[model samples]
Target: MTTTQGLGELTAAERFRSRPLTRLQRIQRLLHKHPEISPLVVLVIASFAFQLASDRFLTASNMSLILQQVSIIGALAVGQTLVILTAGIDLSVGALMIFVSMVMGSLAGNVGLPGALALLVGFAIGMLAGLINGVLVAVVRLPPFITTLGTLSVFTALALLMSHGTSIQGDDLGSVLTFTSVPVAIGPFQLTVGVILMIAMYLALGYCLNWTSWGRHVYAVGSDEDASRLAGVRTRRVLLSVYVAAGLLVALSAWVLIGRNNAATTSAAVDANLDSITAVVIGGTSLFGGRGRLTGTFIGALTVGVFRNGLSLARVDVLYQTLAIGILIIAAVALDQWIRRTGAQR
Candidate 1:
């Protein structure tokens, strides 16, 4: 009886040790290692759930609409992602975008300048705004949150002042308003140039962040500024570069906004700053900084679009949609905290 018991115990131990990981377990392990993967999984599950609720949810036209709807937010989120990757935030991004649009409208629509030249001027102005923010953070040593918060008010006021609390809308917008109307066919779907631009920008940014030395410096600074400085990273320069790049992205987003909305209004995209941050956080970038993926941000933006569209199709009230987004933001923050704790333990 003792011999039989020993053999049985040995067999149980072997079985326990040799048990192959289940698919769910494998996925959990993958998510644990790469937190960004979690958002993508959520996106898939959300899409599946929505599709089941409404047969039209998965249609090609709706898919195209989702891309179109997200194009502007995705563009803004690109800049926000860079800032967050550096452990910084830019509350002024939306304001800067709107300001640039107003400047573009004023120059092209009212001043009678060529639309192309006006676009260039808008870009330059946007970069200047970014440069100011960078100087405050990198040189003046101001906290990013404080700097951007102050600038947010300034930019918003400037946008209102520039447009005189009015919107610029007319035939005077010329090709500037119509440029983004160009469409390309993709299999069963059609998407505007703005959507294409958003995708292209993300691709370029992904390459830069994944393959460049500058990108490494960005991560280094975000991870630990003092340590990065000690390790020969030009922390100030990196911060400045990041801010400037974000500003430029904001400007590009402004141009797309003009195309999409066909007007530059002070009131447009009022919540863009918060929305961009939401996308970044939901995409799995820790607000504490130093960890995130560009692809994740893209997925996050799409995820937002999916939620709104899905919820709308289900006839959920708009107020409820907003509540859902708020819930998502809270859940994402919780997930970030959990990931950080687990990482610390590991």
Candidate 2:
């Protein structure tokens, strides 16, 4: 063949040798094209399946419960999402949350501080904890994982130490919890304030991630820390802010948790940081960083709720329920990795 014909023949052979993209491949390609839609699909599927599996799964009361359940992880996931967006993780979020809750309970319940003042102090303490993480990670040049892991131990120990490992009683709920528990009727459906807040927070963060400059900076940083810095994105400042945001959200999550339960346990939020990370990953956030959607995280929290609730309905042993969560965590992280690989290839 002539040189041009040879080249053309090589191209044709390569094309012929290549496996045609299958339905799944094509779907992945499409999903890679629009990251936001992927989570929506997951949410839809979970909602539909839950609706089918149990008549009570999607009922107004059950839905309210779902909101409360998702709100804890969902609120905390907001911060986790922000941190992950910057390609960082905060193992201290759960610990910090416990510490904050204990502080609040101690201040208002044991120390006789005004409810409002105690709440503010609790949030501030949480923010301060986040600030410490930001400084350690950004200014002190510590790796986020190590710094947060240390803080996780330190903070949780502090919580236990401060309260002498004692459980706090039924302290009054914070505004976040009270508001979330309030019922609202809209046509045929009723929702607590917490559900609305979750929806609002999700929508706001989703927009901020997609539309705002600061949010864009987070994605850019997560996408490429080096490139983001080279682009003058103020990497340290962004990281600092991300942790602070996460801390604040953790405080909010604590409020919701305490509100729904009307108490605080030294043990309950122990694995929250781990669980929050799980939700974020399950929602499709790339642990490797640079790609994820909040909606998926939203659904992820709900997916977790459904799984837990479903297990309850199925009468699984409590130990098995924990085992199932462990399994799901692994599966979610695996799926996230797979999605990341597929996205990278595309």
Candidate 3:
């Protein structure tokens, strides 16, 4: 055969080689395409491992308790996910929640406002906090980290000032403020309105992120802000909106906090900012941005609860649990780096 014909025939044969990939290869490709899958797998494995380690870990009542414990953190993580998706971070989310809750407490309990009005005011405060962060980051061109860090201190101080460092607890709190504690049974599990609210937020956000044009723009901005701007995306507007949305979520978390803690304490959710960020990272949301899923965040929140609950059931100390969480955070980041490298190589 002529050299050209021989080469062409060989190329045709190569194209016709339709061997299927092995199961491991298929799994790796699937994981690469969907970063959230790894976290889900980890969550399931952790649950099973905990179940084996402790008899109480697998009980329906214990699972319900875990959900309740994670609900507030999960709510905060929702907003955190949006900020991180835009290649931004908000250290002020927990502080925002506390400040808003304090507003709710002061308005309803001290100022004699109706419970409903107090709730609205609380939401407004949360939105305002978000707006400040947005303006600083999007309009003033400040780094998100710096903006939120500054706002974190500001919001915390505001909460303390507003509450005077005292928790609001009295008959003055209306049914609206206490509604989060009202429980309803679902099959074998009992759940509170707060937990339901947390789940609903995830469902709504999952749809928004996966299906909306705005969501696409968010990912685009995170992936490459300059390119997204060149493609006619309103990068600043998107960033602002994301921050605002995150603020709204934080307010909702405050509401849940009231329901969970049964009081609007200034110290409520003090660790939420770190916990939310940890859940985002461990849930397989890329800290570098442009890749993640709310479902993963949901699982990540549950995973944290599981770890704490399981460890307690297993007779581990609180200090050890904290250390374990720290270790998990480091391991998750390491895994994230490995996944990114492998995907890049692929």
Candidate 4:
């Protein structure tokens, strides 16, 4: 009986080891193991294709322009990435940013507060807004989509009321508010301070996500909240912290927005909330949560900028540019679904 059992176990092991991965399975496994790889590939292909279509697309000036254009969306995506990683979404990001920018502008331009102090207050309010969202989702057990959707309307109304539907011009906002617009030359590329700041945020957030204990908890909570809670992870606290962190990033993005647009207006980046989500999705971060990288988000944002700029350079119609992006978004989500299935099968 013992000899028969041993032989059976050996055969089972051999069969398992002999199971071969098909080509599609191999691709799925590669993407499952490294979610960022697919987006990186897409970015490379898009860049090469655009460069081929328009020589200007590869020029240093145009490259710098793309980085500049993507800065606000990229920064917003950083916060969105954190929220989505926890299986949540923040439709209020753009509204919160505009609200914060309006407050910052009013404090400095109208209330006579110093720009730096106004910025600090804006940051505090941003965290407070995030805290409210966190409380609703983490403590009250409301769905993330619903909570953010409600806040989106609330924040938008508040912004309009605060600004009285007026824009704060960059001239009245003082140098401090617009400092991110300052240009810096590096060899052949001309990048703004806002672009550099956005890049720094990515590097810092990437390090934290990959190397820190809190980051691990974030992934755990997003992966399986019940399992993580059973494992002694503070799942609720992780969720709360993620929203607050997202808020802080949104506040920072407001500064970049002001610098980029040279104004604080409620009308600026009306599509930013969706744009951030698009960047996150295109970057290979699973909407179902807990499987993504900031690098992918960065690349995704750049890809959007590239597509618009490239299409324009190629003299494609504006509507076609948007259609191209829509297609990319759909493709990214489909790819994500396929990758998620791989994990389910395993």
Candidate 5:
């Protein structure tokens, strides 16, 4: 009887130990279920629908343009996805982007730094700003919304101070602008540096989130902080890492912006925080946090990009585009809630 009981106990322990799957398996399972199709698929459908709606949609010119336009915003959205995955939100990303951009432009143009070195400084500034936000929320225990909100105002003010509330021309920065202007082509199709940035970001983050131990910690922390802590996951560390990751991404986007337009403007990323949320939400990432994926963010970014490009091709007014995005963001949130409720019922 004692031997039988020991054998049964060992079997149960083994089962428990082997239960958890890697992040890739989790993503795969999600795709297999209804309502969790890769957000990228929705983006593709949206693109096709827009093409069908207008003659300009399928042209190589328009397609390349669409990809280019979404690059900077797409980069910002990358960070947003990371922070959101931890069941948190950062409302200051837009303002921080402005600050980082200002620093880059002013440093390289006025301060006489080399283009490459100036770019490095911009990323460092973004990381520092992000560190501030992370410390505020994770260490200081301030509410994520409130903490980021305060930083938003401060960062915006700082940006204004740095630029004297003026836009910086690309006059001194023309050398750097060439990087954004040059397009790499495959046969007849050309893609901008921005598009390449977005794609590279997607690949890197997807791997980190789906193939690494850090990704596991992010999911665990977001799913249930207290439980994750009890299970030996360092919840605070994960939160800090997520915020820092987001900030670094925002800085990377600053490069794309400089490269694309060759000018730096304070308003460039003003709507980024909202758009990032919209992209993540539309991508099928849960705003409430733990149940999101970067793949969804890519799709979400594409959806927005497609909507904007399609509307432009269809000759719709720009304000109407804003309204459509508003509606979509609200709808995505509602759908997330409904899904969670349904899952609970089951």
Candidate 6:
């Protein structure tokens, strides 16, 4: 009787140990290991679905348009991604971009400053704005949401004041300002300098995030600021640098924005603050921070562009397109929550 019991216990233990993961478990594991996979899969599926709905959806011309449309938001999202990876948010992204672009436009068009000089001034102002936000968040220890919310209002006012409620046309802004609008043809695809610049930013930031010590510290800070501090990471300096870096990118995007619109208006990209955040979240970057890829962010921005363009091609109503995007945002957040919970339990 004892021998039989021992054999049965051994069999039961072995079976339990050898149990295969269920499909859901496998999916969770995959997402945990590679958060971008979910968004990439979604992008592919959505593209195919849209293509089926409209034969024109997959055409080179239409595809190029989508890329063009996404470039501004994609660039903004790169900065947003860095801030988010540090477990912070910036509501002032759009406002800051507008303010910088307005400054650039005004200097170039009204003050007769050389376009190159105006751009350099814009960059300096952008870094200054970022520095302010960083100081508030890192030194003053203000909550990011509150800090940026306050700055958003401030930056918007500054842009309006600077522009005097007017726009600077590309003609007055000169070749340097409009350079990003110049188009390039690559095989079947038509692309802009702005698009190429956005891609380059992604590649550079992706490398920094994945392969550098600074990148690891960023993840660590986002994952647990207190723990990171305990581990000897200068959490405050990291936070400060992130905001400053974000500011530089914001300035870069402002240049792109000028080219894309063929003008710099305070009104341009008004919806970008939320749109950038939406792209970041949808790209599989955890809102809670410390987990995400730049590739996912690009995919997320492309996904939004695809959805809108595809839906328009399908003759879907604008309201429904907005609704679809809302649904995507909620779904992405929910998935992130689930992944976090499951990982904790394991």
Q: Give the alpha carbon lDDT tens digit for every residue of 275-304 in model 4.
A: 999999999999988889999999999989
Q: What tens-digit string does per-residue lDDT give for candidate 1 at 44-94?
A: 999999999898999999999999999889999999999999999999999
Would you estimate the TM-scores of all the predictions? 0.91, 0.85, 0.92, 0.96, 0.87, 0.94
- What lDDT, from 0 to 1, does candidate 1 have? 0.88
How does each model score on lDDT?
0.88, 0.75, 0.88, 0.92, 0.79, 0.93
RMSD (Cα, Å) of model 5? 6.0
Over 4 Å off, model 1: 1-29
Best by lDDT: 6
What is the C-alpha RMSD, rounded to one decimal, of candidate 3?
3.8
Please write out the lDDT profile of model 6 over residues 79-173, one tens digit for every residue.
99999999899999999999999999999999999999999999999999999999999999999999999999999999998788999999999
Give the per-residue lDDT of model 3 (tens digit) for 263-298: 889876788889999999888888888877888888
Query: How far does residue 113 in candidate 6 sit from its true spot (Å)?
Result: 0.6
What C-alpha root-mean-square deviation, in Å, does candidate 1 show against the real structure?
6.1
- Per-residue accuracy of model 5 over 99-214 as CA lDDT, tens digit each: 88888888888888887787778888898888899999889989898999899999999999889877777877757633665688865668876678778988999899989999
Error of 3 at 309 (Å): 0.3
Counted clashes in each candidate structure: 0, 1, 0, 0, 0, 0
Task: Tell me the spans in candidate 6 whose CA falls farther than 4 Å from its real position.
Answer: 1-20
Candidates 2 and 6 compared by lDDT, better number? 6
Ranking by lDDT: 6, 4, 1, 3, 5, 2
Looking at candidate 2, the ten consecutive residues that score lowest on lDDT are: 1-10
| Candidate 2 lDDT, 28-134, residue by residue in tens | 77666555465566567766765676777777677666666666677778888888878888788887877887888777777877768878898898888889999
Best by TM-score: 4
Report the Cα lDDT for candidate 6. 0.93
Q: Please say which candidate is ahead in lDDT: 5 or 6.
A: 6
